[model samples]
Every structure is written in C-alpha cells, then in structure tokens.
Target: MFLLVLLQVLQPAGAQFCPDLCVCSGGAAELRSVQCGGAGMSALPVNVPPDTVKLRLERTLISRVPRAAFYNLSELRFLWLSYNSVTSVHPSSFVNLKALRELRLDGNLLTSFPWEGLRDMPRLQTLGLNNNRLSSLPAHAALFLPNITYLDLSSNRLTILPAELLDLWFPLPELQKGPVRRKILGLHDNPWLCDCQLSMLTSLSSSLGSPVVLMDQLLMCSRSMAPSGMLLTRAELSRCTRPSVQPAATRVVSPLGSNVILRCDASGYPTPTLTWIRTSAYTDCCQQNLLQNSEQPPRILESFMQGSPRVGVRWSIITLNGLSYQDAGEYRCQARNMAGTSEAPIKLKVMGVTRLSRFPKRKPKKTPFKSSPKFRKPNQTLPEKESPFIFPPLKNKIQKV
Candidate 1:
C-alpha cells in the first residue's frame, strides 16, 4: 500500500496514457513536450497530453489533417509537421489553436491550403510553406495573416499574383513611416511571367532601405513578350505605355423612369484607375455656363471597377436608376496611371415625361345652384384663372395656337 501511494504521487494531475512509439517529457505536475516520428504511425496520436506546449511529428505517413485534430491542446505554441505526406487540411483543423505562435508544414505534397483557417491563429508569425506545389493563392490571403513576419513560398508553381496582394505588400511611401520591422519573404525558384506587373516587383526590390527582405536568389521569367527565360532585372519594361479606354456606346438614348447601364474597359501595363464623370448637364440654361467654365471639375459618379491581373485590363460599370430629365448629360470615362491619362466621352439623352406626372388634368366642376339666373350679376365677368397643367415649351421648339 505504501508503494502504490508513492506511484500515485509521481503521476501528473489529469494525466492520460501516452501513445505507443512516442515520447513525452515533463515534471510530475504537467507534460511540456511530445515527439512522435518514424514510428510507422499512419495518423496523429490521440493520447497527447492537454498541457503539451511543443509537438513535433516528422517523417510520418499522415496524409491529411481533419477538423478539431488539436482541439484539446490549447497550450500548444510550437508545432512542426515537416517532411510528411500531407495533401490537404480541413478548414477548421486549427480553429482551437489560439495560442499557436509558429507553424511549419514544409516539405509536403500540398497544392493548396485552407487560408480561411488562418484567422483562428492570430499570434502566428512564422509560416513555412516552401517545397510544395502551389500554383495560385487567394487575393486576400494577406488580410488573414496580418502579423506574419517570415513567409517561405519558394519552389512553387506560381506565375502571377493579384494586384490586391501587391498593394498591401508595398504601400505608398507616405504611409510607410517610423522604424520598419524586418520581414523576410522567400519567392525564388518559381516560373514568373515577365509583364508590366512583374516589373513592379523588380523596382520595389531595388529600394535601398526597404523593410522587406527577399532571398538572394536571382529572379527569372519563364514566359515573356520579348524572349523566354529572360532575367527580370535586365528586361525592358519601359516600352509599356499609358492606359487606353474603349467605351461600349458613344451615345445612349433612354426615356424618363427607365434604367440604363454604361460600361467601359481600359488596358495598360501598370493597371490604371477608371473613373466616371459627368461633364455637362442637360439643362439649356446651364449648358452654356458649364461649357464656359473649363476649369470647373466634373462631378464623379459612383462606379464599380474590376481588374484582370493576368492580362493587365480593367472594366468600369455604372448603373443609372430612375432616369429623369436631370440625368441627361455628357459622361466621361477617365483612365489614369503613372504613364499618362486618357478619356472617352459618352452623351446621354432623356425624353418623355415620368409616369408619376402623366395623370389627366381635372377641371373645376360648376354647381347648378351657383350658376342659376337668380344669382347672376350684370356685365361682371368672373376673374380668369390659369390652369396649373400648363408647362413651358422646350427650348428651340415652336408652340401651336
């Protein structure tokens, strides 16, 4: 009985039996580390202690990670699953790893990752995804990993990246102030396309004191307009010109109380910003005044803009709802970039009255008693009153009597 009591005192509180072919080490109060590798394991160990802070599973035969695989390990901080045959991971696999700081999944057969699951790991800073077969990444991946400092994406099959990701990676010079933290980004050993978009990467990499640190490997383009397998640093990208706009319709005719959609497309080397502006109103009195004031800025209309990064093209669209006579105007589609600016004009014409104003006019009714001879007056005519339905004739139109 005394020996049994001593054995009980040596065990940890709420401790469970460790898995076979694995090793666990810590004091009697808690388990701090677990290492499982090359033990012919086909799946993750289920009996890992809840208090484990570090877990390493290397050279295993695990194929995929299921949801809630580590739900019981809340204190886990450092996880290394290198050199496994992992092909995919569930979106919710890391939902419970709130305290996870560094995650390494290098040397796998993954073609894609569950980027949405990264939101659960707010403290994650170092991510190792090199030596995989990823061809593309989501445009908003940077939004999920806001605190990422070290990102390894070398030896992949990436060709083009979205403009949204580049904008976040290198913000405007005015917005970058104060002491910038050192960030390491590994983007070598990929087949990058040589285009106006790729030129941005070369220019940004040459900056003297940039906070970002790209690996020392030289970048080369696999496909380009000039020649294949050309060095990115020596490519002639200055031949790319400013944006040009192509309007769908130069003149549009619509009736009042109707809807109309205007569309225009722009193409350039460095993508350009598309804007819709109202250059002149339809009012006759304001038409001359608007044309005389050349310095007056045109009114900008709310529009939706979308881009295709692969082809370096963008489209702008605007919908006019409940068209009124006041909506008739000349609209200009403007595309601007570092190279230069271009514009295309579209004239809109509105006709016919609105449905709400098309009701028949009613005349005042005459009562028999009021019009009787007994109430008649001699040679005194009732004051003439004009009807409210009378409207002025349109400018430059003849009125029939």
Candidate 2:
C-alpha cells in the first residue's frame, strides 16, 4: 500500500484527466486537438481538454446537436461536424463558440437554416451549408453573416428571392463598381423562376463589382412557359422585352359606392411602368376631375410572377373604392418603358345589379424567352459576346468579359 501510493504520487497527472473515448497524446492540460471522426458517436464528447483547439466529428452518426453543446470549449477554433446525420440544431448549440472560425454542416438532413444558432460567432469565416434539404432562408438571415467570407447554398428548392435581398445583405459602398469587391456567393443547383421580379436579382448581379461572383455558370432558370433552362447572364432586360396588353379590352360593370379593380398585364425590361388614365367622352357626371386633385388615391400596384421565363406575364392592377357616377368612364391601363408603351382600355358601366358580361376575355401574351451557350470547363476560353456577363468590365475573381 505504501509503494502504490508513492507510485501514484510520482505518476503524471494528465493520464487520469484525458477523456475516455479520445486518445490523448500531449502533456497535462496541453492537448492540441481531438479526432472522433468515424467514431460512431451519437453526441458531442464532453470534458474535452481545456487547451484543445480543433475538434473533428466528421462521418459520425450524430443525429442532433443539443443546446450549448460546446459551451465548455471556449477555446475551440475549428469544428468539423460535416458528413453526419444532423437534422436539428438548438438555437444555443453554437452560441458559446465565439472563437470558431470554420463550421462545416454540409451533407446533413437539415431542412431549414438555424440562423439563431450562429448568434454569437463573431469570428466565423466560412460556413458550409451545402447538400442539405433547405428550402428557404429567412429574409433577414444574411444580416447575421457579415464576417462570413465563403457561403455555399447549392442544391435545394427555392422559387423566388426575398424582397430587397441585395440591399439588405451587401451595403451600397461594398457594391460600388471596382475590382475585388464581392465574395463567393454560391447559388447553383436550384430551380429559379426567371421573370420580371427576377430582374431585381439580375440587376443585383450586374452591380456586384469585379473579383466577386455568384456562380454565373450555374445561374440558370426553368419553367413550363416560353423560356426554359436559360442562363441568367444572358437574361438582360433589353434582350427580353415585348410589350403588349395581357387581355383584350372589355367593359367593367359595378354599383355606386361599390369597389372594383381594373387590371392589365405587360412584359418588358425593367418591368414597364403602369399608368391608369380615365378616358372616354364623359360629358356626364364623370369628367376630367380624375386628372386633378383626388384624396384616398390609389394605394398600391400589384404584380404577379407566373414562374415563366424572363418577365413572364407581369401585371398592373388598380383598385377603386367608393365608386360614384363621376367614376364611370373608359379607363386605360398603359404599360410604358424605354422601349415603348402599350395601352389596353376597359369601359365601366355602373348599375344597381351585379352581372358578368357575356363577352370573352383575351388570350395570354405570346412571346418566347430563353438562351446562352453550352457549358464549358473553367479553364477553357470563349468569345466576348457569347460570354454571359461582362459587367465591372475591368476585372473580378473570374476575369471580367
């Protein structure tokens, strides 16, 4: 017993301190890293050495990440949680990893982004969320990734872009035309609906200066309409505008003090501006008054996205409230743009009874939208005009056309 006690007292203190599942090699409290990769672990290993900087759990059977999973590892800088079956992450799972630089969550079963999970990672540089089942991202989610330099959102299902997405993500100063501006914004392998609304995103793509790219080659759109499988780089407004009224002119009937809506659809680059004008020989109570001062004016202009190709059937709708005798007239829905303008008229017949006209409505606007060259290797060279985009013409990470 005396000899045993003496031997223990002389032994190294690190032996009993190391985690049972992990293989510790360094001296006491000085372990550099831990690798539980392919260890078939279902959860994070706790009681890690205090000085440990790298922790790898790749190819593990871990299914979920519990709250404050890494709270004790304040010094952890590199975390590898990829190639696992992780599906859910508690909002506080990564809150304590303030020093984490790179987080790999790819090849998981995640259906949605846990934006709240990254609340405290100020030094996080790269975020790999690729090859997941994410269908959408919170509109304000990009606001939380200012320090992130590389982001991967490839392979998922998304049809529309969030409103004011570019404005909220990259500030105006960072978007100024120049060399070396934007970072790697991967948006490949998703079904994008390229329509007038998509013009907003394409316009943003143009403003994103040199040295930065959003995976131009992978920028493609698909739909059952005229254009399908078209590259976004060739989807310029000027190249895709054909203005015309959606439906043939008709007559609208409504009662006094009732509500009514007149709609017109047009197609073009920059989405043609809509103007509602009261026209017709209205010598009756309805006069030129509509051309002058009027309170409770039109509130909004509604537009629709049909998921067709470029500018596939844009709409302009106007609402009229508290209708009176003075409101009865021939109203014109004019669609205008730099290319030109087209007007479609509707006659209003007010009566006490609600009725539908036996007349038929017009057919859809006929126009085909699609284009761009075949795919090529990144190392291959190509012509100037055949190239998709040439903006920030001077230079970028990928050479400017």
Top of the candidates by lDDT: 1
Distance from true location, Cα of 381 in model 1, Å: 22
Error of 2 at 120 (Å): 1.4
lDDT (Cα, 0-100) at 108 in candidate 1 = 87
Report the lDDT tens digits of candidate 1 across residue range 171-250. 55766666556677788888887666556655665688766678844667788543677777778885555689999999
Give a tens-digit lDDT track for model 2, residues 1-401: 35533554466655434454566555445647776756557777665665668877777778899887887678888887888999888878886788999888888888887786676788988888888888876777866876677778777666655543444444456455553335676777878776544554555555736333565545667762226787765665435443566644478877768998777767765566666676552333333443243333432234322222345456766677888666676777777654345677788766542334588888755443222223333455545445344422234425634
User: Where in model 2 is the C-alpha error above 4 Å?
Assistant: 1-31, 173-181, 196-208, 224-228, 234-401
Clashing pairs in 1: none
In candidate 1, what residue range of length 10 has the lowest lDDT sum? 388-397
Q: Which 10-residue span in candidate 2 carries the lowest summed lDDT?
A: 299-308
Q: Please, what is the whole-model Cα lDDT of each candidate in the order they appear?
A: 0.75, 0.64
